[model samples]
Target: MNDQPAADTARRLTTQEAARALGVKPATVYAYVSRGRLTNRRDPVGRGSTFDAGEVEALALRSRREAAAPAGELSVRTSLTLIEDDRYWFRGVDAVELASRYPYEEVAEWLWTGGPRPGARFTAPPEALAAARRAVAALPEHSGPVDRLRVAVAAAAVTDPLRFDLSEEAVLGSARSLVPTLAGALLELGAPAGDGAPVARELWSRLTAADPEPRALEVLDLALGLLTDHDLAASTLAVRVAASARAHPYAAVSAGLGALEGPLHGAAGRLAHRMLVEVLERGGAAPVVAEYLRAGRAVPGLGHRLYRGEDPRAGALFGRLADLPQAAPALAAARDVTAVMARHGLHANVDLALAVLTVSCGMRAEAGETVFAVARTAGWIAHALEEYQERPLRMRPSGQYQGPRPPQPLP
Candidate 1:
């Protein structure tokens, strides 16, 4: 063995060399230094910093070690939408403001194809609506709303002969028709097409078991607009994964719906709804919340990973419920829950607001999820469209193997 200092043996690299070693760009190397993730020493005779190869290698190993799941440390570039600093933005427009001011279709138009023109009103063809209705009815009574929606999408896809046309115009045209069609079918609205009413109003008429009030209708519209898109969610990732394979929009949307069906993603609304019911029945938020914590279960709808404070969408939706006289009790229970969470430094999320909307409108327990799926369809289409422009099949991530090595021959 040769005697040598550890520093003398450790290799040093320029910024660019370090980037290559890390399998990233030079800017990323700088970023790693700025984030204090890697150490950088100033170049003795030149401009930029130099990285210790050992440190860079250590960082790469740590990155791999920490990323235990598919979701860990993955980043994708997109100009479609953003969720940062507790604010959601679609093409730089504030989503909270757009939800209160504009229709969801308009929001979808901006997401799918960037332009100044507002999209045409969403109207479904009679045949497509009929096809979707049959699909929804065929589902078992135990099926969730998302299940019916998923089946309806598949059924509609089978009915459209031109669904293979993956052109942007064709795909967008289908999306515009499909979302409203799915909503109408779920509500069983048998009205003629081209009626001059907001799509949310039509949906509200079907979802609310009681008489539809203006305030409730407004809340539905706002909710739809706010939920239209979120950046790189699980369902959106599924949509992009399918789209990267050059799948047709319908197939891509089906993939999204499939991913969204899980309880952790789209079905959080149902859990939140159940929690609200328990809170209201127990006469306050504390007892039910206490029981949930004692059992080591998280309080559904009480917190989100993204938002540092309250979810802005939750704030927007819940604030509007105040004007409606019918939403008083549900709203009160929701506030109680928020208050209890606040003491522990947790905040309410959009799921809680959606649960409040579900209960206050006298809709079924799964209505919030249905609304979420329908609204998120716009975002899926947007993501698919964006993915179509990218090099196909680029989402293939490298797998790190941990299995045992090949056995020795004749062992």
Candidate 2:
């Protein structure tokens, strides 16, 4: 017992060490800090970073238990992609490179209709456009764009003609019509007219507010480009599952949205933004760090699961954000928080960076969610098209029950 205190005082571990002690991933460790679920003090060199070894062990021990189900049985694999390596290939081009040059609409068009007008405008079969519009209009008033999008997908599924064929035209048409419909419904509360206007143009008009500035459009475009796709995230996987089941485009997208609604997957940006604001609102990073240490509360937006080291994308965007006037303050604070956090040596994830971006743009909490929904629609459509090429019909998993055999034992 005496040795314990001596050892703990002598040796302090980084957040990585603490994560290992807790048998959780390093990212999970950062999440704990962000959420105020765990606390660690700073080292002498830094203001607030050093964590007590004993505290970590106690937390880890408290969490450890027998598996809920045997490991092998519990580990089910699917086609859900994570895109941990390499660039997002939009058609044949790299997404990161293209987004720097093209408008968000172009990227969206590429994802939906295939690289730059390969064919004629995808016109959804006559009644389908009207039905999509009606669905949008029907979304309860004052609903969020993303929520409205989810509802619209559900409503459109029933009325979508050519849903069963999974043909190229059907997929492309669905992409064009649905994107604008959701954009209009969410942005304007008006349904799609399915008129002569180009899908991209209509969507851009609706997405912007009245009296928008030059930068606002640019920001919107940039945000769209940023959120577009992440290889095979949970939402994209959901879209694939629906596609594999031969569900139509709208149904498939609805599936993706369902996955996005989960806290762990898509709500990350919102969570990070809230946490950062709380830090700023209470009294900058120092006091916030102090209180966090005292309370054992974790900080948000300071970590990632995929990037064991650091998120390259976060680093890249961080550099570019120096000039944006609107998002500059939040961006600066993020920089401060990140620099200060290095005493602890944890890196920022996309969520953290995006939260900063969101704040810089002066968007509502809901806007983050909306951005995710809109950006991911392109991926969902792509996945749906992929599924169409695969074995259609039902792609749902089979259930195998494991329980005591009943009648024979009784007999």
Best by lDDT: 1
User: lDDT of each prediction vs. the true structure?
Assistant: 0.81, 0.63
What C-alpha root-mean-square deviation, in Å, does candidate 1 show against the real structure?
10.6
Measured by TM-score, how close is model 2 to the native structure?
A: 0.67
Per residue, candidate 1 scores C-alpha lDDT tens digits across 186-292 of 74433332464567866775666566677788898889989999898999999999998988888999999999877789888888899999999999999999998
What TM-score does candidate 1 reach? 0.79
Angstrom error of the Cα, residue 87, model 1: value is: 1.0
Please write out the lDDT profile of model 2 over residues 241-324, one tens digit for every residue: 778777778888888988887877777678778767866686567776666667886666776656665565566466556656
Top model by TM-score, which number?
Answer: 1
Q: Which ten residues in a row are the worst by lDDT in model 1?
A: 187-196
How does model 1 fare in lDDT?
A: 0.81
